[model samples]
Target: MRRNAQALFGLVILLAGIAAVVATRDWKIQTAMYPRVVGIPLVILAAIEVVLSLRGAPEGERQAVDTALSETLPPDVTARRTRVAFTWIVGFFLAIVLIGFPAAVPLFMLAYLRGQGRESWALSLVLAGVAWLAFELIFDRVLHLPFAEGLLLQILRR
Candidate 1:
């Protein structure tokens, strides 16, 4: 039952990626760059997931680089951790929507590193600075991608 559900989820994601890629076919190369870059990998990975899920590997045969928490953690602890993870995911999404990616990426990285990971302040600051610099240099300066202004920025400018 779980495997079937996982396969279904992967199929849905694969279909969504295909739709996005197809919808951008008429767009100019500059406009389609982001979607194509993201969508193609999304489709490919989701297909792989669906195939794996359908193959139904034994529980002990799962090949993960990291340890699995599902077997070790108590249900309540797992649920709590899942909630926290989703909270961070939603928070990051909201941050991006509110502030745009170039700003949100470093802010999210710093917040996650300091607040969740409890890294040294200096390390967090340096990592965040590097992330921001790389994003600006690669996407803005080199690729010249036009990122959408955040809703907050748009409203503030008007």
Candidate 2:
């Protein structure tokens, strides 16, 4: 029953992502980003989930229900972590909107690494800095991407 519910949920999300990609066809950036990157993975994952859910016990000589029921359920750590991570991620995006990507990206990365990865502070900060440098300097600056200017750009302009 739980597996069925999960499969159904995945199917819904998969369809929604596909619909979003289709609906945003007019926007070149969104179209390119969604169908190839997000949509494909969602569809593939949904399919795998559905397959797993549909596969049940073979013609049972003896049902394993007793054994399955006896086994302790795993901790809900993944679900809890997912919720927390998503909350922080949304907060990070909001910060980007107000503070700008240049500043927000590193802050978000560091927080995610430290809070989620449970890594040492020094390592998290160093990794975040490297990521910022790679993206801002190597990608945005060198490649000359017209990356969206955030609040940081306003300050830089002044």
Candidate 3:
């Protein structure tokens, strides 16, 4: 049953890849470059997955894979972590809304990497800085997407 499910999933992936390729057909070659690159590979990988899944897993191997997949954090711990993760997500969104992109992106990255990942302070700071720079360069400088001032800023002006 598990193998069958995997095979079915692979088939769906294959179909999605085919759809992506078909959808790109009407697009100009230059415009379609990325989708074609991604879609062709997805189709190939999905087809390979389908073929491999059809080859039956050894009895013990399937059980081991299932065990690995099913393994999860202890119930209480998992519940606590889930709550924490949700809180972080909400907090990030709220920060973005209240502080705007430039501030929020680095702040959230630093907090999450430091608090959740328990990464070293130096590494966290470095990563946060890098992320901020990337966001500033790509979305702000290169793309020229206008990010509105945060609500807090807007409110303070009046």
Candidate 4:
């Protein structure tokens, strides 16, 4: 499930990046620079993720991540938690698709922390607040990456 989840997310990213890059194909070279620079790498990384997941783990080499996880939780609990984790991931992706990152990030963070992490409301909110600030400051304010708006927004706008 873990590898499959990774592959699923990778495909999503790859398709989106490819679309962005293709959309810029007719633009001037200067105008195309940003999307190509970002989208090309995103496509490559997503492909890598897909490839790695398909290849499976190396033979005779135990994965440290799996080992650590096993040490932390029993097999049954680990399996249950892993499935829950994947569900959360899919949920977050849906939230982003429906609501846009500006709203989804904090909402996902707060809900995940409170519900899955079983954290206190105050702590969950604080962590979500911190994450939102960091995202806005680093990505939106400083880097100025143009994030795709939600599909719902487009429909609502029209």
Candidate 5:
């Protein structure tokens, strides 16, 4: 039953990826590149998963690839860790919404690396710099994608 459910989920993802790829047909190459890059792989991987799931791939095989922490950790510990993970995810989205991507990207990287990852400050700063540079060069310089200013920025400008 679980295997069948997995296959069904994979099929749904595969269909969504197909829809996204098809929808990008009228978009400019630069505008479509991100979606195409993501969607094409999504379709291929989901199809593969559907095939594997239908083939009765053993649960052990899948578990080896992505073992759940809940299986190993104490329930309380797992719950706490899950909450922390969700907090970081929610904080990331909040940062983006509040400060926009340009500022939020490096800021989030630095905070996550130093806070959660327990990396040295120097390493965090260097990694943040590299991430910021890559984001600027690819999205800003090459693609010329215009990220909308955050609500806070828009309000401040008025």
Candidate 6:
């Protein structure tokens, strides 16, 4: 039952994303190279998810573990963790929008690692720096993406 619910939920999200991509495809702004390149894969993945969900679970696996986990885990704990994770994700996106990609990416990564109870500040810093390097140095710098310049860019412009 739980697996069925999860599969159904995934299916719904996949379908919704596909619908959004398709419905917006005709917009003049979407005619650029980026939209089609991104949209095609999104549509394909969503279609795959729909097919998998409709196919149902594999036959050989016993259902006992699923039932046990569903019963054993406290509902409150699940709900709380879900809420916290969702909040963190939303906050990360908000940070990106407000502070720009370069700054927000590292901050969000550090915050999430800390929130997960990682106590090593040094490790977190290293990880965050590496992530920034990969995204900013490798992707944005090398690939020449117009990454959001944030407050720094605005100040520099002045």
Q: Can you give the lDDT of residue 7 in candidate 3?
A: 91
Q: What tens digits encode model 1's per-residue C-alpha lDDT throughout 7-38?
A: 99989999998999999999999999999999
Angstrom error at residue 54, model 2: 14
The candidate with the higher TM-score, 2 or 3, is 3
TM-score (C-alpha) between model 1 and the true structure: 0.56
> Model 3, clash count?
0
lDDT string for model 3 (53-91, tens) is 889645453454343522467767877877898999999
lDDT of 1 at 43: 91
lDDT comparing candidate 6 with the true structure: 0.75
Write candidate 2's Cα lDDT for 1-158 as tens digits: 76667667767877886786676577778457746677777777777766665674233464645654322445476666667868987899888887777788898899889988899999999999998998898768898876566876678789
Evaluation by TM-score, superior candidate among 4 and 5 = 5
lDDT of 1: 0.90
lDDT of 6 at 79: 76
CA lDDT scores, all candidates in order: 0.90, 0.75, 0.89, 0.87, 0.91, 0.75
Clashes of each: 0, 0, 0, 0, 0, 0
Q: Which structure is stronger by TM-score: 3 or 4? A: 4
Clashing pairs in 6: none
Superposed model 6: Cα runs more than 4 Å off:
1-72, 151-158
Q: Report clash pairs, candidate 3.
A: none
Q: What is the lDDT of candidate 2?
A: 0.75
lDDT of model 6, residue 3 = 62
Better by TM-score, candidate 6 or 2: 6
* Candidate 3 wrongly placed segments (more than 4 Å): 1-71
Looking at model 5, which ten-residue stretch has the lowest summed lDDT?
Answer: 61-70
Give per-model TM-scores: 0.56, 0.48, 0.54, 0.55, 0.57, 0.51
RMSD of candidate 1 to the truth, in angstroms, is: 8.7
lDDT of model 5 at position 7: 90
